[model samples]
Target: MNCKLLSVLCVAASVHAASAFTIDYDIPAGNVIVDSIEGDVAKVRQDLRDTKNGWFYWAFRVKGAAGKTVKFVFTDKYGGGPVGVRGPVVSKDGGKTFAYPLDGKSKADGFTYTFGPDEDETLFYECHPYVLANWEAFVARHAADIAAGKMKVETLCKSRKGADVPRVRYGCLSGTPKYRFLVTCRHHCSESMASWVVEGIADAFMADDDLGKWLRENVELMCVPMMDFDGVQAGDQGKNRAPHDHNRDYTEFLYPETKALTEWVMGYAGGRLDAFLDVHCPWVRGQYNEFVYTPLKDPKVYPATEGFFSATIEKLQEGGLRYKASDDLGFGVSWNKGVTYEQGWSSSSWVVHNVKGLKTCRSFEIPFANANGAVVTPEKCRLFGHGVANALRVLMENSQPKL
Candidate 1:
């Protein structure tokens, strides 16, 4: 064969192989933008969508590349691009579970994957994903309790996109409870780790253990599992969304979910909210972002906050993800300052300033991938939730009026 013909055939085969590989964001909580594919490298970026600035929340799946290796490159320039500390969490069995790619497969901006010979599909995300279906599975686990009226799941409200936002009520639902607490998570849609922690708290309330029984008999707990339901389901980077994200919408109440939650809590609390815990995940990776900590939003509530932190830290020592009181970010420290709220009031800020007789209101930041030196996982997050529940019991007991 002529040398020219041989060279032409080689180039044609390479083009066909590159064209055969495909990338998409069609799964639940999926987000990605594939720019182009050349040989074994695919240029892509997070679909920023309505996000006002660069944020690192993205998930996507690749197919038709079995037995081949591909290097995903984030072409857009964001603060740190879309890659995470532990690298892209990968799932081969259809998103049911995920794990960070083995060492040497990840870099500062992306990761490489060599799909198994028989593996037809794979999912990758900035972190382990907890979508609406995960929450539904959790609710299903308590089916008997839900049927018995021990737990209730109702729509918080219809999101702007017309999806039913879920609100869970459990513990002391019969008569007026001595203590009422509100726990919220997923104000930032991509902050899925918080949902796991919230599940742990709910599980604690439903369990037959001492803390659970105490909570069931004396406390009425309200939890909004996915505050930004639309963003969560749509795979949006809910942080710093245009106009403002759900957390920042507390003041203006632009979002339906936030408005509904605020009104419901106001009416339900009736001037006596024991505590308001807003669960969240910090940045992709960094010092404070890698630890479990709470922001001290209000200095006036420092004593109450200190007491709660002390109790939680002590309980944490029993078992669960490690969290230290020293990790708490005080007001005006780091990003917990006035500038952070220039966009609007966060849930913690609103609850502290508006909810009368509020004992203590604070936002808990659970790292997306790591807590201290321990790697964050669904089980660990739930265990942390249990610790939080135990601490709450102590906080409530200590707040009782003098005999």
Candidate 2:
């Protein structure tokens, strides 16, 4: 072979090897559209799917990029871009665990990552993702309790896609309890951080501590961890979906999940729900999305809601994520007005209007990445959940009649 031909072939091989990296969204809860890849830079944007307007939720996996630094640049043409305050929540271990790479590698539109020598693959998400695997791990952790019947895991309903939606009944599972609390998460499928909070709440209620014992005796907690199971699993942005998302379907009971959840709650409560807490994650970044807050619902229930917010703030101060009473969005303040629900009523609103003897019905929004300058980690979110559990105990205690 001629020397010139050999040199040309060698150069072509190097170029091909350098550009062999692949990006895909085939995993569970994955969403992304790869635009193009040039050298080490990949142009990408979130896959909006059935989302009405623009929503910021995306996840994808990078493979064959080992030992190479790749820069993921997201486009903002399709609504708000997918980048958050602290950049991407990344999992080096193939989605087993994720943490925000706040190590100065992020820009306003995207982030850069350098894969390790042996790192065959890595997962990146808008926020830490919580899918069925995460939930199954939690269930496994409390296997003994579940086996003993202290915690009952039952199917909430079959999703439209034929998946079994799980509902966990913790605390006071036997007979009737003095109080019944309904806690739900993931009304918006992409709000994965809230699932960590739900796990934290369940942990607190099932612990052997004084609070857990008291809860097991006096309160019956029903938790529907994933409300939009199909959307969550399929990685759909469940907020403002076409006709309406699961949250907005509360009034008309459009989605099968919403219908089943409402009917189940109504029948299970038997006329009264002491507390209805729906956990969610606010917008990707900015203002109210950067902190933990509850949207005040209904004027007649404001006083009680105010007291509960105060209690939660007090408990949060003791430990966990930082929350202040001033952060609570009032009923008419900002986007808390009725026009926001023009499509339909939200879960909290529906419960407030329909459920009888409800002490407090509110939605708690946990930020996706940042909360009051603190990085929102799974463990920290769980700690926040503990604070919420303590606050709920206070609310229940306040509701009981004095002897």
Candidate 3:
């Protein structure tokens, strides 16, 4: 071969090799802001705002660097912190499943992961995140249940950006249900684990167990899985967004989701809205943030809410990362102190006021990444969710109608 031709072939091979090291955020639930790259290190930022400044969303994928260490120093600008003690979430199988902390060498700013030669691409995130992709997977699994009156699906609203928000209803809505259950989740996009619990609730309640059978027969349960649909897609914080977020939209109804659900609850038929479960995740970690808790609500439903929690805690004793009754985040503590619905009304507060003859408007604060020492995984949360249904059914069965 001529020297020039040989050189040309070598250069082409080099270009092909380099292409394997690319990184991107173009897939579903992809959220990342790459600031710059130097050597084997990448400086990335979390884009936590749909419209305003925030720091609660982050996700990205990386290629190349196989068998070599790559450093990602993410800026902790607006409290979008690590998952548990680990640094971000890492997904090796194209984001289907994930493991936390990137398993990297920790740094003051970020962490480093030495990718295995077999690792093609791995996704990293602020926490263990569930995106539209996860929802799609769930939908596919339960499509039959949804279609056959075992479960019902409602479109909460078209988002400002045209995404369809889902309101999943199981059991009947008419005929004076003996008990009614309402579940709202993902008011904050960064709190991804909340939706998994919602899944557990619906899955368990629709199963063939006593709770599931009874739920289908006499109870009507509805869940708004992703209230801030656009925010979750855009990787926005969805918590404390300027003007208002979906959760904060409970009163004035600025967001389309807020408006639709506000009206739906107010106009509930037969006035049997017995239980309202607002699932959420607390800030990264701290004294009140580690375990699950229910922020204080109206004193009127305290007994009912307490009863529900006691029942739930009793049923959730299946080992890893479970919920406890002692973790109750009451008034003046956790997030209840001086929290204002000034922007509008928060979800729990709005439900207490809007749902006439409401039984218990309760909130569940799950951890974003870790609960106590146990890492909060989707499966565990789902199990906890199922167990919660057991409790709800027990509570319902034990109560009699008003005289």
Off by over 4 Å in 1: 1-19, 103-105, 301-303, 307-311, 317-319, 400-403
Tens digits of lDDT, candidate 1, 91-115? 9999888887653456657778888
Tens digit of lDDT per residue, candidate 2, span 1-403?
Answer: 9999999999998988876898999887999999998889999988889998898898899999889988888976453466888888888987777777653567758888889998888888888888998899899999999877669899989899989999989989998998888999999999998998888888887899998998889888888999999988889889989888999998788778888888887887775788788999999878899998888865764336555555565555433567877788878889998899998988887877778766677788999878888878888888888778888888766664211
TM-score list, all predictions:
0.93, 0.93, 0.87
lDDT of 3 by residue, 341-398 (tens): 5667788776665565454567788886667677778888888788777777766666
> Looking at candidate 1, what is the lDDT of residue 329?
84
Give the candidate order by descending TM-score. Answer: 2, 1, 3
lDDT of every predicted structure (CA atoms): 0.83, 0.83, 0.72
